[model samples]
Structure formats: C-alpha cells, structure tokens
Target chain A: MKNNFYRAVYCSRCELIGSPETITAELQSILATSRRNNRPAGLTGALLFANNCFAQTLEGEREAVERCFERIQIDPRHSDVTVLEFGPAVERDFTEWSMAFVGDPSATSPDPLAVALFKDIFADNHADSGAKVLLLLRQLVHQEDLWAIA
Target chain B: MNQISSQPPIQTDDQNIARSVIRTTTSDQAAALRESFLVIEDGAILLDARLRVMLCNIPATIRLGHYGAPPSRGYPLTKLIAHSSALDADARTTVLDRCSAMSASDLAGIEARLVFGDIVIRIRRLALGRLLLWVPASRAAGESSLHDPLTGLGNRRVFQAALAAIFTKPNASAALLMIDLDRFKQVNDTLGHPVGDALLRLVGQRLRACLSQEDVVVRLGGDEFAVLLQHLDGVDALGKRLIDLLSRPYLVEGHLANIGASIGIAVAPSDAHDPSTLMRHADLALYDAKAAGRHCIRFFKSELNARAQARLALETDLRRATALNQFALYYQPLVDIASGRVTEFEALLRWQHPSRGIVSPAEFIPLAEELGLIVPIGEWVLRHACRTAATWPADVRVAVNVSPMQFSDSKRLICAVADALTTSGLPGSRLEIEITESVLMHNNAETLETLHALRALGVSIAMDDFGTGYSSLSQLRSFPFDKVKIDRSFVSQIDGKGGSGREVVRAIAALGSNLGMTVTVEGIETDAQADFVETSGGHQMQGYLISHPVPSDMVSALFSPQSPIASAPNPEPVAPAGSRRLRGHDHEK
Candidate 1:
C-alpha cells in the first residue's frame, strides 16, 4: 500500500441529497458478497457525501476493488460514481477497517425509505459504517431515477 | 373567579351544562339523541362518554368476552381494561375520576399509560361520559411530532415545553435529566442500520422502562433524551434504575450490541428557573458526565455552574482589570526564619471590581484560567509586581505567582519577563517566579525550556504548591528549580494539633536539602507552626505572622530601622543545628 492516494471517497448520488444508512448498507452487502467470492481479497473503503455528491475510494485486490466500484456506479440505487483516487492503497489507511459515516446534514432525510433508513442508521450508530457506499445510497436510495435529482 | 385563576378547573353551576345541552342538542335534539343514541347498542356492544367500547368491538369480541343488553348504560370502567393484573385498581379509578370531572377542553390531567401486551397506550378521558380513548404513545404506532421518529420518545420541542410548564408552576419542583447515548455512531458504522435501529429501539424501550409514571421522558433529536422528574425520588434510585435497565444485552440482529446513556440532571428552581436554561444546564452536566465516562449519571451541581459563570465574568473582568488599571500586586513578606528579617516577598493579584468590593484572586484566578485569560493576566501580574518592587532593598527578591498557561504559552513569555526585568531596571537575579507542579506537567518541555531561559536571565524559579502533583520526585529531577514552597495545606497542619505535620515537614525539608534547594514553609501564621518548621530543618518561611500582604508604601516602613512595624535592630542570628535543638520553647508556644 502507498500513501499517495489518501484513501478517501466522494460521490453525488443520482439524486439531490443522500442517506447515510442506504449507502452504508449497500457498501456492506457489496463488500461482503465480493469477499465471499474472491479469496485473499479483503475490501476497505471510505464513503463521504457533501453538497449532493457521493465519493469514495475502495482499495484491496485490483480486481475485487474494481468490481466493488462497478456496483457503486451501476447499482440502480446509486449512480454517477466518479473516482477521486487511484493507485496502490495505503497499508494502514484505515489502521484496521471501519465505515466512516454521518448524515449528509447538508441534506435532510430524503424519502420514507430514506428517512426510515437514516433514522435507523443514526439510532444504531452505524451511521458512520458502510459510509463508502452510503454517500451514494443516502442520495439515490429513494430517487425514481438516477439522473432526476442529480 | 374561574376566568382569573389560570389553574382553575372548569366552573360549573347548572347554567353552563344546561345551556350546552340546550344549545347543542336543541329543544327537540334530546329526543333525537335519545332515539339515535341507541346506535351505541349494536351487537351486544356499549359506548360511554369517552366512546371506548363499553363492550368489546366486533374484532375484539372473538378474543374478549362480550356484555349483554343496553351497554350504553355505565359499567365500572375498570372491567373494560385488558390484562388487569398489570395495573392496580386504584390507578384505574383515579383515571376515571379525572376524566369524568374534566370538560373536553383538556386531557392532560386525565391521561394514563396503559400497557397492553408489548404495546404502550396513552389513554385520554372522553368527555360525554365515563370513558377512556387509548392510543399507542410509541412512534412505532404512528404518533407524530411529539415523539422523535428515531427514539420513539417525546421530541425536544415537547420536552422543552414540558420543562417550561413544570418550572412555571408555583411550589413545583423537578430534576431536568439529560441523556446522551455514548459512541452510538460507532455501532452504526461497524454493524448496519437494521442492527443499529434495532439497538436504538432497544435502548429507547429500556430507558422508557426505567421511568416512573411521575417522570416525563423526551428525545431531543439525535442520541439525546431529557427526563423531567417532578420531585425526583432520589439520585441513587434513578441512577440504579438506569444502570439496571441497560444492564441487559440488546440483541441487534445475531450479535448483541452494547451501549449506554450518560445522564446529567439539574433540579428545577434549584439549578435553574427558566426552562431553556435548565435544559441547557442539564445538557452541560450530561456532556460532562459523558466526558467523565459512559454508563454514568450525575446530578446538576451549583458549583459547576458558578465556576462556569465566574470564569466568564472573570475572563471579561481580567481583560478590563488590566486595561483599566484595576489590578494591584499586594506583597506578603517572606521572613528569613533565623534573622526574623524580611528577605523576599510573594506578590499576589487583587482585583478592585467596582461593584464587588476587592475581589480576591483565590476566587478569580481559576475563573481566569477557564476563560483563557490566565496567560495575559499572569503576564500583567509578573510585569507589574516586578516593576513596583524594583525599588525594594537589593536582596529582597519578589516572587510573582505564575499560572501554567503563561509558562507553556511559547517563548513569548520568556521575552515578556525579560521585558519587565529590563524595563523596570530590576536585575533578573532579584526576581523569582512561583509556579505550581501542574504548570510543569501541563506542558513540561516548554515550561522547562522557559524556566531555563528565565534562569539564563538570572531569575530563580520555585515550584509553588509543591505537594499537589503526581510523580513529584521525577518531576524534581526533570526541572531546573532553585526552591520549593511547602504547600500551605501541609504547613497549616505542622502543629501536632491533630496529625503528623512534623514528619511531613521533616520529609519535605529533607527532600529539599537533598535536592539542593531552599525549602520554604508557607502560611506559617502561628508561633507554634513557625517553631515547628525551624526545629524541623525548614530553611525559609512566608506568612501573615511575618507580615500580611501590603502595598509598595508599607515595604519601606516595615524594613526601615526606626519604622513602626520594623523588627528590633540587629536581630539575633540563629544557626541551623543549634536552632533546631534549642528553640526557646517558651517563644515556640
């Protein structure tokens, strides 16, 4: 792992706002599914959402990480994934592994599902986990279409 | 009378009721209602004033047994309640009385919490007759506005309103309890929202179970709840309830989650009279509790708020105290134990508040520190005390008490001391700085380096309030100090009046000698305390017995040969070994 890429993620969900829980839930599922399939590959990423944007950097095995990124980009629940960092990930970037999460206070909880999801994430303290994917999920989770809010 | 009295109940004379029935029902309406009111008598069912099913509703009939005949007629309201064992009969009667007596204008005084299975219902009195209308108070059942959608407890707005009502009631008392879930976000990140929500909902239920009927629990948005306990039973009891409630494991998904609420409470009217103010104070107390540790509960204390308010006032005053020349240094003479002559003086800051007649530094020094004004206040004290004492006799070094903020405040402090020394024309060697052990520990590197730089200017440094810090011996080795002032707490106890002040003074004196620094006993006001220190190998002393802190004008008078407070000319000198062995025991007592 190299220190060059600072290991951070940013994204604008397909919508105008984001939900911290949805992004985190999707990230956890995607990472969990990816890890179950790929051997010797442990995925690590950070999710950040600000000003209606979702961005993150997932780093692990080249193939595992790229596949995770693909899910974030095309998973109808999310869209408009822009890669902010690429290259070898830092060895102790996370020190261990964690989901850095918080509500995009910049935006209110979006829809009933988004609101319920946000409330659940916050109440459970998992608002900070799965943030890598939540950055997009918080915004795109309830949107009827990806490009509508964006 | 009813109009003028705010808390007055609905005044009824027969006119109001008769008028309501006549106006609402009309002359022919009573006949119509008597005929159509029978609509409540369908399917062996009944209706009462509150419209609660006097008999079971159709859906309820399958599970609950039904009543026969015109059920619109009254039955004991208690029989309608399910799971009668959960609540006492007296509680049901009180709910009935309040609801029956109150007009439809208010329901607050007649609400009862009815627990049916796992669901909690808020039942209000129905006005037409003796009846109760029940709705689940929990947000899970669709309560809006009053409850936080997340915590399922009353929201902050409602809590604020509750506090206001409680405070405004004359003779009313309550404790404002603030609760914050510690590190809750960590759970959200590591687990998932589903599990997280499960954890939060569990916490809410647990906290709810901890509350008594007299208590009101409110959720203030995220991870925080305020409980208003009117005439709280006892802090220990409530605290025990919280601990015991959270003691159980919350099963979030497959794994059990662990988290706890840090609670801080301020008693109403005692801590604060205003609602928002009390709420805020409880919040501050809660924050402090959380900072102290999780899974803890603390009651609001006046001293904390006093210290806070005092700090703010002092911080503001200190800035003005310096600019307006309200700061003055009072010197207390440090006597040479053997010569009985004033050799050095400790400089203290006094604030002449226009309204608060001569505010003592003991009360305001801490206030200054809290406000971050200690750095500037300390500099003023150091510079001014040195400037004023510059005219004293050459050997009389002035010791200015320095705060930790000043010592660790970068090299600028060293320069300020130098400036004071240079500007006053007082030799650096003639000035000494007194600092507490905390000053060194707060930021040792800067304090040590700063002390060395001041030493380079020829000023001596003495550790003030020596006994109060940790790892004293190592700290002694780490710093380059010239003297140590035995803490006043120990010196005041030096007399064998109650404890072993002799052994303490001896050990401290021995430590100072071995460390190669002058050992001074401070606050030696009594003759016995002075004799004890000298006999115990203490080298120097400073106290009121030597002389109280005085202005610059009194220094010349006290030290002058023929002045009123001056000691005898050519006072007899005493030796270290002989003085300890033969102190005039008569003079000692």
Candidate 2:
C-alpha cells in the first residue's frame, strides 16, 4: 500500500496566448480549477508560476497523480511539458493545500528570484531538478508565512 | 396504489424521490423499486421542477464529486457546471445556458444529451415535472475507450488519433518507434500469465518514465508497444535508452523475469509522410531488428524496404520450388585420413533456380526455416539421400543435415526418417543425421527423446558445425554423438602460421577422439591443411580439397577404380607419408 503513494513533477512554458490581463486570469483559473478538482481526488500539490514558466508537483495515490498529470500535459496553456520526476514518495510535502500557489497572482511583473530559479532549473539537464524545485517552493512558502506573521 | 400500501419504507433518504414516485405501490413493491434504482450501474440524479437536486444515489454523488461538484439534496442542478473541472469554460457556459433555457415541455422528450470532454449525460423527463439525469457507468468509471485497461497506456485507437493529429500540420517532423519484447513468450510459458501481466505493466511504466511528456507511448497489444515522438532530434539516443531500460530484468509476483526489447524506428517526412506507410516502414525495420537478433535497434532505411520485397519474392519461389522439383541434393565426400578413402558423403541441398542457377543454401536455408518449409524439404533430402546411398558401397555412409525445425515435431521427424529408410530399402546404420549445436542448445527433453528414438532406428548422429555455437563443449558431454564436424572457419585459419586456430582444431580433434567420436575437419582447401588434419588426429577431411559437391550420378565416378581421387593423387608425396602413418596408427586402435 505504501508503494501506491506517488509524486510527479513537471515544468512547462506558459502558452496562454492573450493579453497580460487574460494570461493572469488564465493562470488564476488554472490554480482555482485544479484546487477544486484535486480536493475530491485527495491530491495535494504546489504550483510555481513566474516569468511565463510553470513548475508543479502533485502527490497522491499513483493513479490519481498520473491522471492529474495527464490532464495537465494536454492542456493547451502549457508547452514543452517536461516530466522531471515521477516515482513513489514516502510522504506528502504540501498536505495543507490542494494546490498551493507559490508566487503573487496579481503582480504585473515577474518575481526576479523565482524567475532566476526557473532559468537555473530549465537551463541545466540535471536529474535533481525536480528535487531542487520542491526545495525552493517549500522555502518560499515558509518565508511568505513569516512575512504574513510580521 | 394498493401495492404501495403493502410496501416497506425506504431506509436511505437519497431514495426519497423514488419513494414518493412509488407511494401508491405496496410496501414490498416500494422496497423492490428502491433497490432496483439503487442497484442500477448508471448514476441517476432526480431533479425537481425547479431543477433542484431533489434526490440522488451514491453513484451520482461519486460521479459528480469526480467533476468537482458533489451534489447535495436541494442543490441547484445548473450550479454544478460552474464548479466542474471536467468541462472547459465554453462547455460550462453551453451547459448552463442549455439548462436555464429548458422548458418543462422540452424535458418531456425521450432524451436531451450533453457532452463535455469525455463525459456524456442524458436527461429524460419523469412524471410530475421531475427529470432524471443518467450518467452511463463507462463515463462514471473515468476510463476512456482509448486506454489499455491492463497497463493504463493508450490503446491502438489512441495511437491512431495521435498519429492523425500529428499529420494535420504540414511540414511536421516526428518519429515512430515500434518495439517488441523478446523472450516474453518464454516468461509467460514458464512463470504464468499473472507474472506476464505484471511485467507488461512495469514495462509500460519504464517506457513512460524514459519519455518526455510530449511523447505518446501506447501498448499496441500483447507484448508489443509503440511510441510517438514530436521531434526527430536525439531519436537514436532515445531508442537506445528504451532498449536498455526495457531489457532490464523485472521482478514480478515473487518471480524474476528477464526480457529484452527490439526497436524499429521510422521518421516522418523522411521515411514517409503518411501514417500507414510510416507504420509499415517501421514494421519492416522491426523485422530487420528481430532478424539481426533481439535487443538491438534498427532505423528505417529505403534499402530495407527493397530487401523485404526481395525476401517476399524469394519466399514465394521457395514455396513453389519444393513442389516443382527444383531442389537437388549435392553429395560432398568426407575423406577418412587413415584409409585415404571416402567414408561418408554429406548430402547438401542446392536450389536449381531456373534463372538464378544454383542459389546458395546459406541464402535460402534460413528463409526455408522461417517459412516452415524446412520440414518437408528436409524429408525430401532424407529420402533422396537414402535412395542414392543404397546404390553406393555398403561401407560408405550418407549424412543428411537436419534443421532444428525438423526436430520441433519429433514424431513427424522420426516417421519421415523411418519412411525414407523403408522406401529406399537402405539400412539405418548407413544413414547419419547431422545436427548443429543449436539443436542441443534448446535443451528440450523432447529433442533428447527424439535423438534417442533416431538412434534406436540404428542411425548415427553427428554434431555438425561444432565450435561455432555457445556451450559446444557442454553439449558434447551431454549427448553422445557419433561424430563432431569442426566448423569451416577453424580449418580456413590453419595456414601453418600456427595461431590459436590450429591449436583449437587440435584440441577439438583430441576432445572428440577421447569422447569416442569421429572428428571431421571441414573446409580443408589446401594440401597443407590436409597434412595438418592428419597430424592433429582428425579422422576425416571435407572440403574442396576432397571434391566439390557433385550430382548423384557423378558420385559413382568419384569411387570408380580409375578415379584420380580414389587413386590417392600425387599432389605432394610428403603428405602421403603422414596419412600413411596416421592410417597405421588408426589400425592399432
């Protein structure tokens, strides 16, 4: 039964062809829709979108995770959908949110730090890129919580 | 109405609408009605006159929840589309519009259908302005017909759809790889179907893990699979990676299963623009890969198509050749070094093509084997050789090469040999059946039993083309053979340069002798080669140096009293001395 718990990570370039406002609305819609769908499927994950690039991780039962990934891969809004990692996981990292957002949705400009991390991850064909993305998202979430408290 | 008075009350509130509808029935009738509605495989939701969710079963609740709209009693039905993840924005708007505009009269129709993504829903009117929404079980299970149920990979339908989608764009460059698993049948036969199924699922996972998300992998059914790549760059590396990953051993159901993959690739716009042609080219390349030996990758080449065409034509010709009497047996004498006389004549098959003259056995034998024509052709050779050998001296034996296919059905093979001996009126002792190491490599008990049966018929078995296949030494120790024929490559290597080839021939000759088997060195094309065979303790020498394989009529001329070959020609006087000394040494034994 433990072997059934799986996690998958994928990164893609945003191909939402529209104005800035429309792209922002599309991005928000993706997050809201995925959250609504993931809750019923018992899937927990986080999405990081910045500089017209997106990296996401989903964790759940193997079948659920794979089905969710399949839908994401076919979505017209994403291009060059590269699967970085897909294997069994010991435990979930983002159990609190159905789909936690990592960057500000309303910001007109991209976050420089998030954009830099995206470039680093995509530029090198390293096997650990998925792990690196997960670590970055977890740190960012913790920092945001600290800021909210302050 | 009287039936409703006798019915018991329904236990679940979800069936309240059913209870209300059947209120006039007896208590038993009401309970049965409720049970029947609940037991229906399709999800059913009852909506009130205002399109409110008046009642629903567990199937409906689960199906709605999967679309992100878990229905509750009294929840407005039109609001479900707003929260549905199964539908896009346009589909949601369309569904909402259709529901809001529907009149009570429109709901009275047989069925009002709605489609969003792969889900289909049908709404039908019930009595008293109530409407029932039916979601078939197939959609409720969330499994599309495009998927393989066992592996969750896309099925052939999905593959065809993806292929058509690719070609819709002009100037598109993509590649298709056709993969077949080797030794999977053996695994299934040895380990059972459960393990084979588990291994296939694991194979699908490994294939998906190695490919990009943009690429599509599908189970083409059974142990064969295919992949469609969006780009042609790095295709070779991807093919090699797939072969490597799939060939790794799989542990399934407490059993370790080992299988290998052979890949054939065809690139679009280069191999062919259309889908069917591309698939055919890939299949042809796959044939080449499997023929080249399993666990390798082959790319589609224009020449492969041509070669395939040629092979097809040759196959047709081979099929007719057997019945047309175009096949003839050529006899090549194996000279005994000790007596300097012909002891046995190996019957070799030659295809006397009308236009092509004599086609080499090397070219057509494998083709015959693949087409399963080897068995009948082998029977013909056996019969012809036996009849011809009966006319020769009684001491002279005839050796006919038997293909591995002939051994597949040992009963038929034994019957064929028996029929040949009986019809030809030749003793079985004079007929030797020569088999290669491959026959023993299969290691089937049936083959061993067949060998014993043949020996029981007073026939001698020779291990032909030895030292060429793997585990030759072990094979000799396992089966007691009458003779061992050293492959021609070793004899061609004996140039007196004295490399390992000479030492190898010498060692094998000594091994065969110690095992109480006759050793014949093949391809002795030179006088020096003959001298070397004599010195290395070989019993017989067979090659052009002995004589070219002649027709059956000419076989008698070779043994005639005045024959130059039978007179022990004066090619080299010193060579005779070694042969004479070996002859004397053999007499002592």
Candidate 3:
C-alpha cells in the first residue's frame, strides 16, 4: 500500500483566543463528523492551547490529516499563522482516534471519566493533558514487556 | 693565522665587548653570548692590561671619520682608545676587561657598575673569553609589570592597590564605574571578532580621554574597565560624572556604537572605609543598576540587602505553599439583577497560610506569576472548582477567574480547561472562565483562538472586571463574551454614597445592554445598591447583598430556593437558605 502524508498549519487569529461558544461548536462538529465516518483516517492526537497559542498532533495518512489540519487554519476560529512545530513526516504519532477532542472542560462538563476524557481532554484545550493520561493508559494497556504490566 | 695571528686587532675589541655583557646563569650559553658584547662608535680594543672601545657599529664610522676621515677602517688599541688603565678609565671598559680576565682564570668572581649618561652598565663574568649582557638598571627599576600591553594603563592588580590606598586615606572619596557594553557580543558575532577587538580598543581610548591626571583607569579585563574618581564629595556627584563619561557614543571602524555604564559609587568614611568591602558594595549596586536597565547609575545601598532577603522569602514560600495543600477556593455568587436570581458563581482562590491565614489573590498572584507557577496553580483551581460545581445544580455554572498568566498561553489554557472538565466530569457549558479586561490588551489572535477553542467545547466565557481597564470597543466585537461584569468599584459607589458611582453604573449597564451582553455588577454590599442595579436593567449583580462566597458544605443553604426573592424563579428552590458571612472577613488582599 502507498503511504500518505499531511502538512500542518497555524492560525494567527485562533492563536490569540477563541470564544468559548465558538470553540465548543467547532469541536463538537469535528467530533461528530469524525465519529460518523470512523476509521484510521479519523486519527487525531493531542491538542495544546496555551499562551494564546494552539498546537496539535494529528494523524492518519497524508490526505486525511492534511484535510483536518487545513480546516484548522481557515475556520475563522484562529488567525495567526506561525507554525510552531511541523514535519511532513513525523509519522501519525496517534493512530487510535476518530477525532478525539480535548478542551477546557469548563466549556463542556460532568460525565463518566472515560467519556469526559474524550470531549474534555482530546478534542479541546485539555487535549495535551488528556494525551498525557492517554500515554499513561497506553503504557498500562498492552504490554509484552514486564515493565508495562508492573 | 691562529685566532687572526694571536689576539688580532679586531679580536682584542671582540674580547672586550664580550666581557662587558652579563648573563644571569651559566646554563644558557647562547643568551650569554648574545648579551656579552656592546657595539661601540670606535674600533679599539680595551684589554685586561689596558682600556679601549671594542667592536664598533656604524657609529664607528663617525669616530673613524673624526680620525682623519677614513682612518683605514681600523685603529690601534692605544692611540684611538681614550680610556686609561683598569681603575682610572671610564670604568665600563675596565669592568669588561676585569670580567673577561676572571672568566679565563681557573676560578674567578667579580662585579662592577660603570655609568654613562643616565645609563648604568653592570658587568659579570662567564668563561674567560665571554661576558654577559649589561642593560641600564634605571630603566628596569622604573618599569611596571602590571601595565597592560595594549592600553599601557594600570591593570586590575594596580587598580586594587591604588583603591585600597585611596580608601585608607581619611576624607578620600571615589566612585567606581563598571562599564558593560550591551549587545557588544552581537557586533562580534555579526561583523567579526576583529571588529569587536577594534571596538574594545576604541572604548579604552575614549574612556582614557574621559579621565583626568588625578583619576586612574584600569582595564579590569575583557569589556570591563574601571575608572576611579578621586576628590568626589559624595556618591551622588560621582555617579553623575561617571554616567556622563560612559554615556557618549563611540565610533568604531565607522560604526557608531553606544555603550553604557552600570556605575557603583562608594564614599570614603561614609559607605565603607575598607577598599575591598567598598568594591563589593559598589559591585552589588552595579548589579542593581543593570537590573533596572542598562545605562543607569546607582550607589551602594544597604537597603538592597533587605529586598534580596524579601525576594528569597517570597520565592521559598510560593514553592512550599502548594506542597502543604494550603490553598482553597471561595465562590461568589453571580445574581441576575433584573430577575434577582442567582445564575452562576465566580471561583476565587485563597491561601490559608499557616502563619498568615487567608492571603488574598492580590498578594500571592504576582508572586505566582513571577515564579511561573500560575499555570499549574490555575490548573489545580480550575479542576477543583469544576469538580465542586459538578456537584451543584445542572443549570448553575462556575466562573473560574483566569489571570493574564493563566490565559496568556493557549496550550496551558487548553490543558487546564480540559483537565478541569475531564477530571471533574463537569459539562463544558456549566464551566465558565472569567478573564479580566486587561487580558484582551495583547496578542489578540492567540487569546481569541484560545477562547474560541474553549468556547467551541461548550464552555461559557465572560469578560471580567470591566470599566477599570483600557476599555476598547473593538474588544467587544472581536472577543465573544457571554457576559460583561462591571467592576466592583462602580458598584460600591452606586448607592450615591461616593462620587458618580451610580451614574457610572447606569452608563455601564446601558453599554452592556447595547452591546447585547449580560451585564453583571460585582461587589454589591447593601440592598440599596442591589435595588439600584435591579432598576438599572443589569443582568447580574454579585456581592455581600445576596450571598458572599461560601464553602461547598454551605452552598445549599447560602443560595437557598425562595428566601429574600425580590423576584421568583421557574425551577423549584432547593433546601435551607440564609446568607451567612464567614467568621473571618472577606480577605481579598
């Protein structure tokens, strides 16, 4: 099978801040769409929002991830266009996702921990932290190494 | 043929000149040989038995010219040689002869000083055929080992000694200026180090030009030069002069360069009497001056020590406070003034310091910001508040106050908000973040993006503490806000007790309405204030009027269903109700 590639981008306006309402709707839509047609191309990684800047690690093949990354730029949600970190080939670090969303839960709230972890940590602002927790979960999930079980 | 026919005419002069040179050690034969002889103006031999000039240089041409013009390029030992025997002669020749004769003997030792003009020539023996070099001792005595090769000025050691002496003298005062050229490294890196070297030399020259004869300059090594100003009455005057000297721009290789001085001043008998102590104090002051901004001058101050101590104290406590779990969140209700209904609450963090007990956000907020701990601390607050609020009624939202530090970063804000929501299982809509008006002043795009990100996740956002910042109309159109909260200042004065408070409130409430934002008034204390807000079409009013910030355990009673309702609500009111201010006063330090 041929491999695919995706290019990352940054938005200047969105870099500063997004109104909670706008961010919420945008994230909900992204999640809903990804959930509808679920597959590896639905893969998305961590999202980090800090210092009026936003960063994320999205994955799948080049086409799928690039399409997702492109929507982030022109979404009218953010504007500044200084791509902080990008590589045409960093490899989709996150393969397990159908548009997982992590955001400031203050905009979203109370649910069971597992479900909240998705909308609260993945698709939104809290994505970075949630990703960290995911990493921990990954460590404990499947392990041929003894360290993983321990 | 043997040695030019056994002690030939030139050979005799060579022997005499070699004898005159003095070598310190017998170990180095080459140096001994090089220094042994003096080339003179006349070719004549001064021997052990007699005295004469030996091994003439070009200067010998002049002497030969005087000897009847060309004198056959040679002179006999007795006729042209002026000096007499060993003792009566111009002693230089006699000493040379004596040294040579000693070196030839089985074992010999001798020393002699023969003066010519201002030069002192010393003679010592090596082997009988050779003598060591003789140089003028006076020139050596006046020479200084501490002179900088390039500047030819006193180095660090000499400056320290001079400063010590100056300090020890009573009534003496001096100021030390430490010149630190800012961005000098850039010049070196960009233009090449050669240019940087030239710039340094140029600075050295310019500084020297600034000093008087009485003042001393020292190249204390690499871009750091010092000037000691004597006869200064006090540090203030000294600092002024030093600043002036360093303020002038220097032209290096046709490039105009500006360098500033962080001058440290010390007055003798006043600041300190010891030289090193004064220098240390001056250095400390210089550090402070640099910290204030480059190009500033400051005098040694004893109070800086106290400030240093205070900074250390604050930094230490900030680190420890979190570990001790000394923090707690307090909630202030946000009432819909028009309806007189409580809709939301603002979460404010307070520290119950073991010693201070209930420190205000104002006191520790800046400290946290400085230490870069506000992000972590804010994350904690957001999570705690969300979790607590999650346990509240479904429609009730908690407003967590976000400082400039907390919201300045998109990544951190995302993490904190996500963590708060995820960990607490609180719905995004139920979680509202309150950011101050000042937060909108910078990096608009980033703030907007972060806000939008948070908002898109179903969270509500509000502009907090309005009317007290650089209020820009553009902010309202650009940033999406569910509500605009008026400052407590205007609310506190709205009873018409103070100047123009009611009018300001009236105007702000109108503005918020015109902009289509839910207007919340903060810090309302009395019923009259509450009444004024209710009449003003304000959407929300919060303060001591309805309920002060209370703990989780008392929330049910504090925000009770139907008590003191100027108006009624759609949902059935829950449990017991009463406004109970804590035993301690509101500590918004």
Ranking by TM-score: 2, 3, 1
- Local accuracy of candidate 1 as per-residue lDDT tens digits, B461-507: 99887776563777777876799888888887776667576787789
Ranking by lDDT: 2, 1, 3
On lDDT, the candidate that comes out on top is 2
Superposition error at A136 for model 2 (Å):
36
DockQ sort, best first: 2, 1, 3
Tell me the deviation in Å of residue B401 in model 3. Answer: 1.7
For each candidate, what TM-score against the reference?
0.45, 0.58, 0.45
Q: What is the lDDT of residue B188 in candidate 3?
A: 70
| Cα misplacement distance, residue B521 of candidate 3 (Å) | 1.1
Docking class of 2: incorrect
- Find the 10 residues in a row with the least total lDDT in model 3 chain B: B24-33
Docking class of 3: incorrect
Q: Which stretches of model 2 miss by more than 4 angstroms?
A: A1-150, B1-150, B164-173, B182-197, B212-214, B230-234, B248-259, B291-296, B560-589
Would you give me the overall lDDT of model 2?
0.75
